[model samples]
Target: MSTPDPGDIEPPRDPRAAFAELSKIMLGEQPLSATLERVAQLAKQTIPGAADVSVTLLQDGEVASAAFTGPLAAQLDRQYEAGFGPCMDAATSGTTITIDDTAHSRRYPDFARAAARKGVRHTMSIGLPVQRQTIGALNLYGTDDVPFDEATQELATAFASYAAVAVANAGVYASTATLAANLQRALESRAVIDQAKGILMARHPGMSADAAFDLLSKQSQLSNRKLRDIAAELVDEVQRGGQD
Candidate 1:
């Protein structure tokens, strides 16, 4: 699900508690998706008049929904499909977008219309600073007019500031995981190829290690298969022959 279930969200006792919880989430070992979902849920609990919350992330020049709470994802989807909204403007321009009442909003007529249809009366979008630039936005939606006061907006901004660092760290962790997997695969391929080469050398009199490897490479090229695959097949065939 795009948005987190309300039952999963724990209400914080106060702003201090909310900040502490957010810090814990940042330092936790949970994956990026879980961390982002928790951040959105916390935003809903921490901000007054916030019926829903969503995080819009911009990665590789593409905008995507990272996490959300309540039915906010559906509302954000309408804004994205229409190609313009407060959330989009917030991320792109590195500025805050706020509307006290969707019915009276003229800056984003289409977005206002869609949010009004969705029973959203007030909204706030704050840009998230990532490193040296703004890379995302934290969005809050209210069902009543003027749901967020100035204090609420300031608190949301502080949360977004810390969230930016957490998001960037998650990206780095994901990349490291992928690199580690690839390296492990490469090591396995090398070990199998070496074993196949040793088998070839032992089976043929006067055959050098390099010649055996060349033979395996030629077979791989002629069969249009991976070198690792050809090496594995040779090793299996040798084992079967020995057994017989």
Candidate 2:
């Protein structure tokens, strides 16, 4: 579903302003960690009562990276190791979970204690995916016990959705780059195989190149050896014959 239906809440009057900010982040040259740092910094700086923001990355069933600004950011690793925080559950569930008042909730005693000790009043988490698979979460903390109005929560989520796309796009681009490199390597290997067949054809004159290649293929299959290895041996034999 689109983050916020228009009927739910109209965006800021200068809707363009919010989008301009998002575009600037994607197009910027700074590293992604720097970009996430800026995202949190700007959110806390702009939003009323927002005390902190953090961007977390999960890969191979573990947290891979994280970036945050302010005191709350520093405490994230502790919560992760303790295994009792809203962000971890949200990342695993792939949903947004909110705790407006930690004191009353019976769930996650350890996290509640940590939040109380940290003076956290309210918190929210937005799950992000590297693709279809859940991989990370974005968390926001407020110092006052102010549950987000449905509208505010949605706007924040809309922005988080953008963050997820930015992260996933980087991953897809990297995977495609690796595939390109591998395909190039395979093409070069095939060229060598063709070169080996030519050498065999010349050594066994009157034999067609296709027929010579078949001989190598049959020998490789019968001996249960790799075709490349057999080709190498044939080339070596021709070289040794020349020396003799």
Candidate 3:
């Protein structure tokens, strides 16, 4: 019920500079593991009282991919395996959960034991969603016992929002790649059609390849056909004439 203290932490002095760094880090040219490592770096430098972070993606409350910041991540996997922790609660309940001190926290017994072993005394987690679909959670860990103050919580929330957008952008990048591939294939097919046209034109000295192709294209269009069909017809005609 108590709000976090915003005054405890300061927002980035230069939002543009922060974004510039994030943009470089978000570049998808590298492998997902490399990209995720950069994401963790951004989270570490931007968030206060956070020595490490972990990002876990979820689909229907099941973990799809999990990336850790460092040593903390390996330790936290135990909590996930225990099947009782803030991560699950945030994903299923669609709520932001914070723990002041896992040592004394009674909410998730298994989580506390694991946290104790890992030396993570505090945590703040925000659930990520898209149109009522709880996709995953952005979970942050700290050594502080009092948990995230207002400033820290806001920063975490912003990071989580960016994370959600980054995931969507990744999907967009994939779609763009697929479209590019299709475009290339269409171009290659067109190239083959042109070559077939040239072969047809060479057999008839008075006609040029371009003129022949134009004629074939016009015929195909008039007949409501594909250019490949016209090109195939010309190729078959040339082959039969060569035998004669």
Candidate 4:
């Protein structure tokens, strides 16, 4: 379960550089998908024997492939459809799944055979956990028979952890943006509705606010339109009359 010292392995990219790159991506203004796509590409460069890479993301009870380095997208899609494979296990179980040699692997036999046919002999899936639940996985596929040693596993885990932070931050940003948009729309709708009510009251002297609102509601129901839409139309009509 131990690997040779890092000095002995000629990794594709320096682990430190990989982490620094991830940190930069996380801090950038890029969206969640862009960050994960960069992460998958960095993983392929950082892992010693990585031939392909893909990110598996789960949000709102649906699982999907977020990004990939190669034809691994098709491979991952097959696993999703079948509900099997190391990526699925990692994301659902929150545990890293490693297959050193697909030809001799008993776990995920079908996946192993399929991967082997695609020249992927070694594979690993590291869970990306957020808020106590695994939300995604960072998957690595290699065309070598060598097992991923402890150091490699550790590197992959680090990559996934950083990716998880990025995912969480992106989720928060998206939610905040959606909330702001909804609030702005609500405010705009309210302003128009109020304007419509004011016009109704002014046009019909002695009409109460409640009665004016009732008029708008009746018009909305009769026209099969939403109250807001009807309100907007009334406000537009008042503005047009003002110009005339």
TM-score of 3: 0.58
Q: Which ten residues in a row have the lowest lDDT in candidate 4?
A: 1-10
What TM-score number comes out for model 1? 0.64
Q: What is the lDDT of residue 30 in candidate 1?
A: 70
Which one wins by lDDT: 2 or 3? Answer: 3
Worst lDDT run of 10 residues, candidate 1, spans: 1-10
Candidate with more favorable, higher lDDT: 1 or 3: 1
How does each model score on lDDT?
Answer: 0.71, 0.60, 0.61, 0.72
Top lDDT model: 4
Ranking by lDDT: 4, 1, 3, 2
Per-residue error (Å), model 1, residue 4? 15
Error of 1 at 1 (Å): 20
- Please provide, for model 1 over 111-191, each residue's C-alpha lDDT reduced to its tens digit, 9 standing for 90 to 100: 877677566777899988876788778898877545578887888888888777776666556565643443355456667
Candidate 4 residue runs with Cα over 4 Å from true position: 1-11, 26-28, 176-244
Quote model 2's TM-score: 0.58
Q: Once superposed on the true structure, which residue ranges of model 1 sit more than 4 Å away at CA? A: 1-12, 26-28, 176-244
